[model samples]
Target: MALSLKLRQGLVSFFLLLLLLPSSFVAIEQAFYTQLLTNAEQKLEVHLYAILSELSMREDKIELTNNALAPDFYRPDSGISAYINDEQRLLWQSDSSLNQQFELPNVELIPGQHLFHLVSQQQNFWVLSIALLFDAGEQTFPLTIHIVQAEQMLLLPHQSFKRTLLQWFIGIGIGLLALSLLAYYWTTAPLTRLDQEIRKLEQGKQEQLNLSYPSELKVIKEDLNLLLANQNRQKQRYRNHLSDLAHALKTPIAVLNTSALSQQPELKEQLDRITAMIEHQLKRASSSGQDIWKKELPVRPLLDKLTGALHKIYRDKACPISIDCPEHIQFRGDETDLMEILGNLLDNACKACQHQVKLTVTDKPFCLIVEDDGPGIAEHKRQQLFNRGTRLDTYKEGHGVGLSIVAELVSSYSATITISDSPLGGARFTLQFPLEQ
Candidate 1:
């Protein structure tokens, strides 16, 4: 079974969110907490100043005449608490702190300068303190206001806010996930359609793929269409070859029925022409082209196997086959196609070699250049070398199908094959594949 591209993409998206979303949630939570604390502090400052305003000057002695500035100041066990100090002496404390015992934070007196801190007493609390200086009848006195808020003041509001914030985070997280999934579906919709079309093709549910796809998938669609076209061409070629063979054999078969084709001089010549034509068509019919789904062919191992086999056959001649091929270099095609191609080339080169034949494979062009130190092919003959059964040397024991099949393969891969003279005074077949992306 083929791997699902959708499943692979889904996993990739999930991992990306897992790596990023939590950190975003954490940052939001911290910012929310900080903002909540800031708002609470601002409200406390208002109360701190109001208390100082309640102080009344009496007999040149400052007195806090209004203890009822806020109901919490009078209420017992209220989350809000306050105290007043005249210079270094204590003047008053809120009724809320009557039952609780804790040290109050010191006050500051840079005019409007105020201070706040958190401390643990009978319970944890936030303490805000401020100092005010009053002058009456040439007399100056120092007054400080301390506001004590029990932990409930902070905790209660925070818990309420926390619940709301958490709800939002969870809701947003779900919404974000949903959006991500939606975006993925939309983005890969064309691919999903293409996949279905391909499946339909494989199952024979459809005659040909005609699904509308995105621009990015156009190449894939084109390639598939090309495969179908090639298959159709093969069937067409088979029919045409059969028809031609039937027409061609009609005269020969009619003559052979009347006279022995081998014994009769004219019939024997006709038989040779018929046989050569059949062989030519058969060679073309055999090429099936590159496989629709091809596997990579490793350079070194394949070359080693081919060369090792070739060396044994030509062992008496002592023709050395040298290969300069990288282990990791690979041919992206059918293993059989590769074997057929290299086998024919190597066999011919080994047969033609005097002493040394060299095979060099490289990835830059994904090519194999085979060279032999034998009598080189002439320029005029090189053009016809890839023509079926057109051997330059008829005595060389070959039907000359090797280079022609190679020509067909090169055409399929959109590759180039050039035969030239080698420095070793022999033929150099440069079969270059397109560079792998």
Candidate 2:
């Protein structure tokens, strides 16, 4: 449900790309269109000055001294037109204005003053105007020269530029996104390798980190290797101390067995109890308890070995032992710990059952169920069964300790053991180990 580092980074990159690209495109397009408008106004101003240079006044009638101009000005519907006005009465006009009908803008201007802005009639247009004073016989007449160009003229090039700009921006966005993906992968590749190595270590496929790593990870690798070495040394030293203690106690117990204390049944019984307690405690303490790294071991083979030995021990009873387990099902823990748990459970089932015993293994949480056909245990007495040295005197000599040992081993691995009625009309002992510990 949680996202990975690589996926999170990639999502952020794509989100930024989506957000920034459109904003950048709109800003650039608006700037370009503004520049086009400014250029169009400047061109119209040039046309206005050209018309002023050729104007002349004769007998209060406006005329052109030289009627020379650009070819567009001489053609009708050319989208560019010029007009000369004196006090709102048209004095002169370009040939381009003969067919186009447009209302002139009202204005009050001082001589030598110029104005430029946009106007919208049926369509948009740019209008530029300049005011001048014309000299006649002892009088001055105010004249205004105007230039009007249609909006369609500028839109043609603007649209073309928009298309070209869109293509270029799209290409640039794609290139940047590709580079972002590459950078993401390149930066996370080392982490991927480190993850793989850690998985191998957990599965017991490798004892320590073996691959070369970046400097940041190298210190972690060395620390892990040192921890593993220290664990090995501690386990070895612990086993040695338990072995030495057991040997030291055995000698005194042997010597007492040969002395006069052996003649008294009470002393002999106490010595036997002490011996049993020592053995039980040592076994409990030496268990390879919950470990961080464990090997995957097949359950079927271990079950087979335990069942074989149980059959030999209970050959006289001839009880049928049924094992229900898949070949591929594995137990992830110490092999010896597994053997101890299964061996004791199956042995107790064989001893309790009158004619049948069954063992079932499940995969999801690594469970084991051992059942028998004898009378099932009463609910009231079930809790006391896990207590040390708690058993009926009618059972075999070693029966008191088997279930207690099972309880200790199961607890060490953080597993649960429950006693319930079995379908076979006997007791069921179910042990469930967590998949992840």
What C-alpha RMSD separates each model from the true structure?
A: 9.5, 5.9
lDDT tens readout by residue for model 1, 1-437:
12377778878988877776677767776777778667767877878767767776777455677554778777887778787776667777777778767676554566556777777666787877776676656777777777877767667766777677778877877887898899889987887788777666644567567977778888888888888878768756886877787688777666775675466777666565566567555545554454453335566888888878888988898998888987888776655567777888888888788999999888977888999998989988897998876777645354666678778877777788899999989999998887751
Candidate 2, position 161, lDDT: 92
- Write the residue-wise lDDT of candidate 2 on 1-437 in tens digits: 11277678889999999999999999999999999989988998878777777777887787778766777899999999988898859888889989877778787888999888787887887888889898876899998888989889989998999999999999999999999989978877777787787767666788787888889878988998898877778878988999999999999999999999687988887887788789788888778765655667788999899899888999999998999999999887778888888888887788789999999999988999999998889999999999887884366467377788889999998999999999999999999898863
In model 1, state the lDDT of residue 33: 70
TM-score of each: 0.51, 0.67
TM-score of 2: 0.67
The C-alpha lDDT values of all candidates are 0.75, 0.85
Model 2: CA > 4 A from native: 1-186, 250-275, 290-332, 353-374, 392-394, 421-435
